[model samples]
Target chain A: MLRLCSENIHSFFASESPDEHEPPMPRSLTSANMTGRAPGHTTGKERILTSAMLLFARTPYSDTSLRDIATAAGVDVAYVHRAFGSKAEIFRQALLTLGPLDDIAAGEPDGATMISRICDLAFLRNPNRVEDVRPLHLLIQSSLCGEARAIIAQFIDSSLALPLSRAFGHADAGKAHFALSLLSGFVTHRAVLGPADLLAIPEAVQQRMLQTALMNAMLDRSDPGIQGQIN
Target chain B: MLRLCSENIHSFFASESPDEHEPPMPRSLTSANMTGRAPGHTTGKERILTSAMLLFARTPYSDTSLRDIATAAGVDVAYVHRAFGSKAEIFRQALLTLGPLDDIAAGEPDGATMISRICDLAFLRNPNRVEDVRPLHLLIQSSLCGEARAIIAQFIDSSLALPLSRAFGHADAGKAHFALSLLSGFVTHRAVLGPADLLAIPEAVQQRMLQTALMNAMLDRSDPGIQGQIN
Candidate 1:
């Protein structure tokens, strides 16, 4: 099952920038060198975070060592120790770099488009990395572990739930959390079930199911305006 | 990651019979010895198939040894070899014992009840094993492998799609498959997200969403009777 761990997290995440062909490997542990704006230039700390992300995504916590991350990042092992302090801390930072749920949370109230965007984020493959989405996959695969699960749950609460609720015209996190749960299930099912034939279903039907279910999960029925549209 | 393998395939499958306290260790595994069944007795081949199912469900194919299964089943390892020929064959046979699609395929047409039943199978846990359902969990965990994915896809086609189509009063497998895809997505979401608060969204609304979506996914506009009722 360790083989299920992806080696492509670095590629998947780095593919956002065209020139990041190689991982960020600092030549020296100087903050001045790290502060440069070149495409692949990363501070020693950023290098450790990205390296830790890639390594941790591919190997479970106990199997990964600080030395492995340092070597991958082309830095000294002691540099990694000084920057991240511990493997757990490195993992937390790695997930932190996935950016906030601001894309979902900060957007205006457009339930249909918002649902589609959420689905896209959860299920779409990055154009550059055909079959990899490291951070999402890492979170899903490691969700069975207590520590990773807690970290992810916390992230969802602060970044996803609160913002999603505000978008739906309610301050309650319950609706946002439920809507997210449904979306997560759908994504996970598609990945694990790999029911390719299901793709043959008309795109319209799929969209309808997704939009309707999401609206139902996220909004209250007290509003006749939304209720009428839903029916 | 290997630790994710279920240690309970034995318990999950064996819990079907109360008296199966000791694994079936055939004193003689010859064809003649394989024939008779006294109340609770099993043929050597049956024992091997069940044992393989339990073991394979717990551990990945490459990691599990015949010796481990034989020890668990209380049989000689060579007996497993003689009986099933190869690990691959044993795994296929184990899946086969999850039984034919007859239950789903042969049922009376009741879309509401059928949808409810399908949901139950996908989401419900065994009353005895509070947190696990070994075969489903095994399939999800091992789906990254080609063999398990193929077997599961085949099972879904036969068990889920075919019968569900029949229940919808048509022979179209498309509707059933689409509905199933949605249900599978929902189930996978709950398992991975662990969003317990989603349960707070009143049972009536949940049931309505399930039933309505399933009906929409499974029925065509050509059926005025069903369409009228759905509205």
Candidate 2:
């Protein structure tokens, strides 16, 4: 239901500048400079975040540690703290590294094209960066039981819900939420479900289903009489 | 994508029978009490699982601990281990308690009403059961990164892809997988994205989109246009 500009969406997918080839790393923490401090380099924080993102994506959060991130980034533990107050802060930054929100904001007005473009971009981006996404999942799981749940929920709410609502022209909040929910569900299912299971559904049929859902949400704004009925 | 029986779908929305009114505990586990464990005498393991499920649903998985589950279930640490062996197993059993799969499986054929009934059933079930669903989400997240991911993937395969393929009489593995993916995406979206998002698009429009896609898939069988196009 979010209204994205086609150009923006296209940019997200196509505008892969060479700099974006690899995630931003903390250059200051490179092996050559093993010392905790990075003189006059803002990238010190970026490096910590990049390392955290990689680890979170590949490993479960519970299994990952601050030490592991520090070692991987070639930075001292204290430096990590100085750059980002906590693992959570590092994670928050790492997630935003993809810059979906900024992308959406920059590309607007061409809502229909934008939505499709964004989807294509996401599909291409392999949103599931094991080091980053995996830990985020762990954090999400932890939020359900731990004190951090609120923070995680807030992140999801803002990152997903806020931008989505704005894109959809501030239409019915409930409906926008539902649309977002459906999109998230699809992405999650794709990531979690196996190739075998995925292979079960015919490619043609899958494509049709996805196309139909997206088109309907984007193009057909009128009531079609089958809304609640079709499920 | 999956073919659910009408009766089962109906039952999912209907309240429990008056005679069956008891705690939310699964009957299978409760009835397992033997000479040592009485009908009312819940095992420490069961308690741990129950507590874990509640916590998992309400909290995120990473935040939860054996200690939290034990404390809530009124059991000790050892008991938690004696019963499920690990946090993963406990989480798995807790999900089985929700009975979504069982409910879907139990539905009888009623082609005209099946889809609507299934959707209704899903919508009727509260997605806010944080305690119940949180662990499941954790399991799903963890599975993406570990061995258990395969198991979870298989479960999804059997529950959604297999049944739908059988119903459609499609031998083509790829086709079936695609269909399952779409359905899974839809369901996930509904659950995670709030109703608000769904309600954004006119109800009629949503219905038409779904109907078009479903009808096209059924009729064409081969070419459901727009393989990668956004619906």
Candidate 3:
């Protein structure tokens, strides 16, 4: 895929100011953005990105075109084309900005810790990501273009699957890929289908089953069921 | 939730001729359409529908306009609006046309049978249905319009979840809904992510784990793991 190569790619996904209503400070560090900045402060590119991410989050990619993003950002379409390169590039940035996976990756890289953290997040809320700017929903709603698929696949393979496989020494890549895919499916199901009532089983049991499934898949444990089977 | 209410709703989903390329015959029974027909023959509405279904299958719903369908169907835009009522309605019709779930429901409707049939279909092919017309892909690609969501949720509730709950007498509806949601996730993951190399574990063990996850979810079995635990 041709690179979009935003001139400020390094700062393109910097943390937003606590003001929350303003466009994110694309050029500044998080500590600088968070402290003593007025709520109205922003740059043109930050404005464009905020509008683009919000619009992309709210509507399917097919529904929100370059023109729409520009209109929402108060810029013209040509500027958007020049700056973001393509809608797919804009989406890739939004996903990086919104996802928690980076946080997990930046923390402990243990296989069980990774699986348990994801499971904890999965059931902790009801219809959680559907109403928000979530990476899972963003990826789900985006059109399956080569650029976008390649971007997501590369991210998952590098971020989640690779770390997971390394955590289980000498584990072939296939099991890690399958484990992440199943976990993705589990999350996608909730994000796309919205919420259903809680299952008849105790919530703890449900979480254990999910955690066990992922661990068993990820670690290739010989245990017939859960890698950490409930006693 | 106004329906486009095509008068031939029953026949709208009738099985197509194995001839494979022509518009399905709307007026005749499937046996007749399969037995004998000139390769090019089709009804005006059938031609319109065939065009609409193919376009919807190929492109995300937001990108494919009613005018686009009209052009492909060789009809005026007004005629499409007159016939299908709206883009969402057209997609609803298209989903019903492509789905295999109706076939399962039309068969014995056994609980494990329903779950296994879907699982088998999920893994039996590689990157299956991403390149072709499929109900799951259509739903995923379609914008999350209220009418489309309602149509799908209603169908799942009536066809799969309800019957599944019934299979295990005294079961709560919550368990069945959760079970189907997870299964939907499993299928959705495969459809959207394309494919990966098979898991390092034996295929049989993977299937057993998946089956156990779903059966345990659906039946609310008290056993710690796989309702039918592997020996």
Specify the highest-lDDT model's number: 1
Clashing pairs in 1: A185-B185, A185-B189
Candidate 2: tens digits of C-alpha lDDT, residues A38-156: 54453656567767766654443444568899998889999988878887676566655533344444556344444553343223332234321322343322321222333444555
Q: Of the candidates numbered 1 and 2, which has the greater DockQ value?
A: 1
Model 3, residue A76: C-alpha shift (Å): 14
True contacts kept of 2: 0.28
Worst 10 residues of 2 chain A by lDDT: A1-10
The residue-by-residue lDDT of candidate 3 on A74-166, one tens digit each, is 988899889889987876665555543554554555666666655654542211222233344455444233435656666666656677777
Candidate topping TM-score: 1
Which residues of candidate 2, in runs, are more than 4 Å off?
Answer: A1-42, A60-64, A121-160, A165-170, A195-197, A200-211, A218-231, B1-112, B120-151, B165-231
Taking all chains together, each candidate's TM-score versus the true structure is 0.69, 0.54, 0.58
Q: lDDT of all predictions, in order shown?
A: 0.54, 0.45, 0.52
Q: Each candidate's root-mean-square deviation in Å?
A: 8.9, 11.5, 10.6
lDDT of 3 at A222: 39
Q: Judged by lDDT relative to the true structure, which candidate is superior, 1 or 3?
A: 1
